[model samples]
Target: MFDLVIRNGLLIEADGVTKADLAIDGEQIAAVGLSLQGRREIDATDCYVLPGAIDPHVHLQMPLAGMVSTDDFRTGTIAAACGGVTTIIDFVEPKPGQSMLEALALRQEEAKNKVAIDYGLHMTIPTWHANAADGLKEVPAVVEAGCLSFKMYQAYEGMMLDDVALLRALTAVGEAGGRTVLHSETGPVLDYLRAEALAEGHVEPIWHAYTRPAPLEASAVHRAAELADLASCPLYIFHVGCQESVEAILQARSRRIDIWGETCPQYLLLNAEEHLGGPNGALYVCAPPLRSVEDNRAMWHALAQDALQVVSTDHCPWTFEEKQQPDFTRIPGGVPSIEARLSLVHHFGVNQGLLTLERWVEVCSTNAARWMGLTRKGRLAPGYDADIVIFDPARIKKITPATLHEAAGWTPYDGMEVCGWPRTVLLRGKVIVEDEQYVGAPGDGRFIPRRPSALS
Candidate 1:
């Protein structure tokens, strides 16, 4: 006998969708086909049973820039569960005088007994540490510790890596069979632009976007891709928001490089203009600050053409109260989207005819799982984990914090109309979300260990 059975739902596997019944035994799929019996049964007529989304970019309770995000693992993962995400891979920023593995362990303790869903972490190697020089040595230890990916930043010069150090980290990924993800803004150029903007009294939130405009990003992308190619490393550029960045990725691909890019909903939906005309638009603030409307359209085109491989939330949550804390620079730097990611993508991309339903699942779920190296986590196939989402393609709803599960208590996607919503979310055969509410327990999340990439 199975533990749970989902009946009469159209299953969306990697290839396509088809009618099927899924059976679960403990934490894995026991059977899939027709009329399977289990202790519990879900009637899923007219709904799509898809693999639970694996969001590879999320910052829950992450301390950054001086303030910590308001969403802890409990709230963040609950929000993720309600939105049909099965697994979340967050970052572990190493503190001064800490080992990278020790840093990950501390983060795991912080998340333990608090998360409502499964989670994994990427180690952010700060440049100014002896540990960074020790990066090649620590790669194997962390990979063996279930943390397989490492992130390097270019713009946070004092904190992130230098290009030489960046190259060393990339070569290390090749050595460890691990993957590398980067925040590709060029720090020196950004510092120059910021200095220029400040000297000109461009303190407005919109000016933030203008300050770190496309050329800096374009130059950074071109350089970062070249470095990755030189190391023959599989590099992923995170939250790309401009045309030149896309062009850089395409340029690298043309030269037979295996580099990838991920764009957020904000870049594909909102633009830099949202941050215009003083502090009124400050609520829309985020780093790499939102780009032009033309950039938005370009991002959509990239998604449609497969130039970008994943569409993730970058789901960093914060409250309006927290954001109102005087200096815009002092306030938090991220907006919440875990609860709205899948629906927003479906509404704008699929419902508006920009993306096919299959492509919606691909961008939001499958590709994210694959990119994050969670091979068995992104599809509703026979052998994969029963991480599933039952979504009503026609359910209409407005984005609002009234339905949010995060402690941040706000949504940047607020007040927008959307035409889809997740009905139930199952992670490892356990239904963590039901009827748009979270029912999972804290401590339920497990650290995800990734396999070394085959290409490496």
Candidate 2:
């Protein structure tokens, strides 16, 4: 007999939705057909059975500018469960001169007994100098250890890499059959602009957006795409917030470059005008700050047209106190969206017809699974992991800090109305969330071993 079955739900997929009953045998989907029988059955009439959402970008317990993010693995994964995300890929960031292997082991230890859902990690290469190449020789070891992607920053002070280093790292990773993801923003230009802003006494949150203009991002993206082409590597751009950057990415793709673009809900929904709302606006401070409304519309169209492959929450949450600094630079640069990502996307994308239900599943779940190398976790087909979400499309809720499970003191999308909500969430055939309550325990999550990417 099967372990459990969900009956009569419209199963959403990459192409369309199908009415079927999904049976779970142990930790995997055993069957997907009409009238599947199991030891236990839950009726799901009128609900959409979607593969559990996979958030490919999240920062749990990340340290930045002398402050650690408020949400640790437990709170972060719990919030993810409530929002229908069964698997998350967090980054393994190492300090300058720190061994990548040591950082990976330490990060895994921190998340081992704390996370409440399945997780994978992307390793970050902070210092990629001439000497750094010898260190990166261990990359293949970690790729064998399940960390298949590497992140390089082009903007942040300590984490940023020079173009030479970036090109070399990309070449090495490409040769190793791995993917390279980049945070593309020109550090020198940003430094100059920030100094100009500070000298002009324009230190407010709004000036943060002014300092990092769209052209700088586009310039960096253009340069990175060129470097990826030269290195013969696949590129993944993170937090794409402007049409200028999208145009750059599209141009690279037009040349037949294997590059993927990722945008977040803040970029797709919120505009730079959010920065004009006084000190409270500092809550939205993030790298590659929110962009124009025109860019928002462009991001929506890009997703619908298949130009952008994934939408994730760069969910690095800081507290209200941490964001209350007088200078814009002192304000922690991130916002919490893990709990609101799927809802906001559904409310804005599918409900408004900017995205079809199938595209919704694709961007939020399946595509992420494919891109991040989570082969078994992103589909509802038989033999896939039984990570599922029963979504109620007719449900409506106003987002509020009091209602959210994130440890951040507030939400940037608070008071925003959303239609669809996850009614039930299952991780590996085990119910983790029901009726908006988290039923999973700490350490229930396991590290997912990912295979090497085909892009290389």
Candidate 3:
């Protein structure tokens, strides 16, 4: 007999769905077929059994502008477990003069006994020096350390990389057999616009979107794609937000470039004008700020057509009071949706008939695992880790800060009604969440060592 069995559930995978019983042995899936038996069984009648979602972009306990994101590894991974995300990949940012390897070790120490679910890390190259053999020279060693992906920014002050430096970094990572993830936005353009806006006394939250418009993002995407093509690197763009950017990705793919794109739930459902202009507007102050309603429609279409491959939560957040700044520039920018990503995407994407159930599984789980090299974590098949979610499509939930496990004390999706909440979640064959409450403790999670991207 197996260790556990989930019987009579509609098993969903990236390519299809079927009604079957899933058996778990030890910490991996043992079988998936009719009449599976186990020593312990969970009745999953009228539910969808899926590979737990994998969010490849999140910023728990990240430091920025003299403050830290409210959710650390423990709280954030607990919130992620409650949302059906069984695996997450967060970034490692090195401080001034710190080697990428050293920073990674420190970051791992911080999460050592804290995470509630399996996790991975992506090295962030805030700055690089070729002559001094700074960050670029360590690419091979870092990749060998199991961080097979690296992140580069095109917009932040201390984090942005120039074109030459970006090309060098991309080449190094590509040669080391890893993928490059980019936060693509034109830094110079954003700086000029923000300066102009502040000079004109337009410090309202709305100016945040006004200063970083769609075209700026599109241009930066095009540039990044071109550089990736030149370096022969597999590229993944994060938080893509507009039609222009999608068109750029399409053009790049048309040239047979190996590239992928990701979008967040906020960009697909919340619009700029609606969420960025009021007494509570500070809550929506994230980078590459929200777009128009038309842009939202475009985002859905892109996902349906496979122009975008993943929907991750940038999952960085501060308390409500911490967001109260005198100007948009001073406001801590991020949205907390670690506990709401799955339900939001299901309600809006599947319930609305915009995304097929198969596509939903692809974007929410499988694709992220494939692209990020978490081979055993994202599929519901024999030999894969038994990280699963039993989703009750009939259950309805009205979102509120109190219902969430995030420490941020607020949510961008407050009062939004959604269905298909996770009735049960399993992390590595262990039940971690049941009936929408987290039953798992901190340190239940193990660090995952990843391989090079499947694209590589």
Candidate 4:
């Protein structure tokens, strides 16, 4: 008999959903058909059984401005698992003198014993210098060690790469059979704007949006896309929040460039106006600060029109106390969204008719796995990993900090009610979450080795 079976559920996939039963043997799907038999079975009537969501962008235990992000691997992956996200791809930052391979080893060590769900890493180059090319030349070793993507920043101080550095690194990564992921924003302009805002005493949280305007992000996207094209590299832009950025991505794709764009829940459902509310507004502060309602509408249309291909949380949670600073620029900028991401997408996208169930799964899970070269993941079929979510479509859960698993102690989406919730979550046929309670061990998660995608 199969190890486990889920019966009487609507199986949701990228192409469509089917009323079927699923069987799992060992850690992989053993069968997907009518009336499957197993040693143990779950009654999934009135629910949707989807391949577990894959959050491609997240920062667990990230260090920023002298304070570490509150969500360590244990808590962050617990939140991910409880929310039906079985896999997360987080960044691996190489110190100034550290080789990419060294950074990957250190990052893997950090997550190996703490993450409660499956995870992967994206090697990130913090800065470029005389030995930058030499450091990147080892990218093939890192990719061979299981990380197929590299990240470069064009925004943050101490992290931003010059155009020369970005082009060189992209070329090296492309030559290494890896993808180049970027954080697109003009760093100097943003620095100047922040100084201007502070000099004029525009220190409120709302000024965060004014300092890092949409045009700056768009210009950076255009430049980065051009560099990727010139280098003949595959590019993936993360946390794109504005229409102009989307336009830049589309314009590149128009020329047959291999480029993919990602936008987060904050960009899709929240607005910059939230920063005008009060002291609490600082909680909404993040890089590529939230944009206008027009931008939000444009993002929904773009996702529907296939102009944008992925929706990740970019989940970097910090505490409320961490965000109370008068200097908007100094406020720890990241919002807690992991626990509510899947439910919010279901409520707003599928339930509201903005996206079909198939499209929702594609953007949240399938596309990420495919783009990241997670070959056996992001689908619900025989031989695929049995990471699955039993979602109760009729359940109503209002988002609240007290109910969340992120260590941040607050949620930007507090008071928002979502229609669907993950009733059960399984990682490779082992139940990690059931009835919203975490039932997994700290080291239950395993490291996922990734291969280079053909997009390169």
Q: Identify the leading candidate in terms of TM-score.
A: 3
True lDDT of residue 147, candidate 3: 93
Candidate order by lDDT, decreasing, is: 3, 2, 4, 1
- Which pairs clash in the backbone of model 2? none
- Please write out the lDDT profile of model 4 over residues 1-456, one tens digit for every residue: 889999999999999889999999999999989988999999999999999999999999999879999999999999999999999999998777777777788888999879888998998866753235466678778889989888899978778888988888888888888898889999999999899889998888888898888888999999999999998888999998899999999998998988999888999998988554455788899888999999999998888889999899999988878878868888887887887888888899999999999999999999999899888889999989999999999999888888788898888788888899999999989999988899998898888998864232
How well does candidate 4 score on lDDT at residue 111?
Answer: 92
Candidate 2 minimal-lDDT segment of 10 residues:
127-136
lDDT of 3 by residue, 219-297 (tens): 9999999999999899999998899999999999999998899999999999889999866888999988999999999
Superposing every Cα of model 3 onto the true structure, what RMSD results?
A: 1.1
Q: For every model shown, what is its TM-score relative to the native structure? A: 0.95, 0.98, 0.98, 0.98
The per-residue C-alpha lDDT of model 3 at residue 341 equals 95
Which model scores highest in lDDT? Answer: 3
* Candidate 3 off by > 4 Å: 128-132, 453-456
Number of backbone clashes in candidate 1: 0
Model 2 lDDT on a 0 to 1 scale: 0.89
lDDT score, candidate 4: 0.88
Write down the RMSD of all candidates, one decimal each: 1.9, 1.4, 1.1, 1.3
